[model samples]
Target: MDAINLVSARELARRNGLSFPNESPEYRQARDELLAEEIELRRHIERVAEQRRALPPGGQVRKDYRFQGPDGEVTLRDLFADKSTLVIYSYMYGPQRERPCPMCTSMLSAFDGEVPDICQQVAFAVVARSPIERLLAFKKERGWHHLPLYSDTTDEFSRDYHAIGPDGGDGAAYNVFTIKDGVIRHFWNPEMGFATADPGQDPRGAPDFMPLWTVLDTTPDGRPPSWYPSLTYGSGP
Candidate 1:
């Protein structure tokens, strides 16, 4: 048989209706397109990121919502960790939920060391509507200390950013903002546009954080149309 190299086993698996073992000419061609697709996707994603960067300053934030730190009495501005750009991932550990969202916990688990790396460049944090003690308890339970954690217990900040919707619903979102010259301006954020609503919340889109694709590159099976687990203190879970 003629030798063919493929770019991605996943694509090869997709194109051939079965898994492609090792790189073949067919695999190579598929891999090339896969590479091209990645670049295109990167550019496409970056275009959206640029849109976030381009948002005009809305003005100074009207409210100074409170959050808790080890010390206490911190405001929204304080959460920035002294970076001009601040990213807050409003987490789903709310007063009503029985547990912190596993997926959100998974994404946040990556932020451990990533916090310091980005903190050197930008401020980053995770906030939840749950009380400070409850949020911290979950933080401890999850072993997530690499990133700064806060509690938007009062509901002011989440409400202003549209991070939280109707009451009796899940709370939290991925929102990025800027504070300059003492004014707060919205920047970027993510949402479940079409994720199916669990019970009470509006129908939202599926949670899409791409880890599966990156992980599957290693062995025979690769990622099976799934998300990848996060890095661990040792090996991943």
Candidate 2:
């Protein structure tokens, strides 16, 4: 919908009948104002997505990057399976680290449950610089069954995709590729990182992908400042 033709978000919010038990007039007024902003935010998100979808054709893939999956070595095109669109998430789980990045693991844990639904629309693959066997073992340990894990055995894909730093350290990456008329091409990937982060906030892409953060954002005390996800949390339900 065009912004100029639509009613103002404040007017729409003011017309809402939602009310909570024992909520004071002050609370309702403040909430209605916040609701107006939320409506505007939703419109902004839709606008951004529409612009992204309208982008011109991206760069074509030249190199035949290979990865090792449970079955055997597979080319980047093979990762697409039956879908024309593909999404690859390179988690920070290189061989140098004794354990996978807890943050990545946390994100994947949430993704695991949605893989089936996500794959219905586009192919999704989880990649790491670690060996296939190592990745499989960790996947089993985490009880993740749906994530299609692959190993960037040669680091060629990782290097080209900016998942590997100049110092050889691993970094998290999320890339989208599309195949049209049997030609694979790069689609989109978030460029925001440490260099683009705002003051007092961590570097993160727009439309945050992590459900953990999204959930915490709804609480009064949002995500903790110093706290981070761990491989294991000591004794909990």
Candidate 3:
């Protein structure tokens, strides 16, 4: 069988049956152009993911990092359970902070519902520097039921994964690890930081993990420059 070539994004858009009745010609033209760009962006994201999956073997994990969970002490290897992949999201809730980072809380809020489905393919856990009791209390207060919360009681995991700065400030970090043939190794992380951010944009990891900013981006006002998530707000409407 002869291999068929894919059509250009613009051609694909032109051939699509989607239509909005009573829409102006200008709107159609603009929409079609945007559609093509969206197609290209989707392709680019796939390419980047492919590249990530093709990365060479990452650094070997030498330390047996321990975490405090509701069930008691669990090691780094134990987090993987039966899955080969493990995703750890380091929430910015350290012992010194009176409250957790609103940004991390917002992201975790979204993840709470996804944990069940996500865990089907890979093990997932949220780690923080706070005590296990405090972490669990906040988890309950925020109404998060599915997200597995753990405490990096000794701060080693946080420091090793760059979740805590040299000065001891907490930060949000996402890291993936792989366990193969009884060997645990680092996989990939979004190393982008404040210093590498583009002008007029906040420092964001590639493929922005949070859905909040992605949803806000569709608004006319877009994401506010000064506005950010808050730990608490006044009484509900």
Candidate 4:
């Protein structure tokens, strides 16, 4: 849709007749105004996604990185499977840590349910710098049946993809790759990080992927400043 030809968000919001049982005039007025902004926010999100889809082909894969999957070993190209596009999420789980990153695990918990749907379009996999057995054990513990877990035992892929920091610590990373004409190439990844973060805000990618934050954003309280997810909550997994 062309923005130039679209109706104004304010006009659309004003035309909206949605009302609650006990909403006052003041509440309705403010809600309509907020609705207009929400409409614009939706459009901006689509605009950004369109821009991303229009990005030119990215760099080619330099090394033949290997990973240990449930079945056996696999290479980067093999990750694509039968699809042309592949999505790899590098979680913060390494040999040194007794548990996986709470944030990453929280995000993946949501993703586990969506993997089946996501894989219908593009291949998706989760890679971590832990042994295959350890990764699978955690998967079983979390009851994530659909998420494809792999171990980056050699750390080659993690090191090249920024999952392994210069300090040798594990970091969360999301990357996309595409295969064309028998050649695999990088697609896109969130480039914003600590260096690019706005003052007083933690570094985050546009259209945040975490559903936890997205849901919280709709509430009056929003996401708390210091609050974070724990591996287990109230003695429950």
What's the TM-score of every candidate structure? 0.71, 0.98, 0.96, 0.98
lDDT of 4 at 206: 88
Q: What does the lDDT come to for candidate 4?
A: 0.93
lDDT of each: 0.67, 0.94, 0.92, 0.93
TM-score of 4: 0.98
Candidate 3 per-residue lDDT, tens place, 144-165, comes to: 8999999999999899999998
Clashes of each: 17, 0, 0, 0
TM-score of candidate 1 to 2 decimals: 0.71
Best by lDDT: 2
User: Model 4, 143: alpha-carbon shift in Å?
Assistant: 0.9
**Candidate with more favorable, higher TM-score: 2 or 3:** 2
Off by over 4 Å in 4: none
Following a full C-alpha superposition, what root-mean-square deviation does model 2 have from the true structure?
1.1
Q: In model 3, how large is the Cα lDDT of residue 65?
A: 100
The sequence of per-residue lDDT tens digits that candidate 1 reaches over residues 57-160 is 64566776788765787987887757888888878777777877766777677667577788888888888877788877777877877867777767777777
Model 2, which residues run further than 4 Å from truth? none
Mark the regions of model 3 whose C-alpha exceeds 4 Å error after superposition.
1-4
Pairs that collide in candidate 2 are none
Model 4 lDDT tens row, 1-237: 599998999999989989999989999999999999999999999999999999999999978899999999999888899999999999999998988999999999999999999999999999999999999999999999899999998998998888988799998999999999988889999987899999887788887999999999999999898899998888788
| Model 1: per-residue Cα lDDT at residue 119 | 86
| Candidate 2: worst-modelled 10 consecutive residues by lDDT | 228-237
Report residue 181 deviation for candidate 1 (angstroms): 1.4
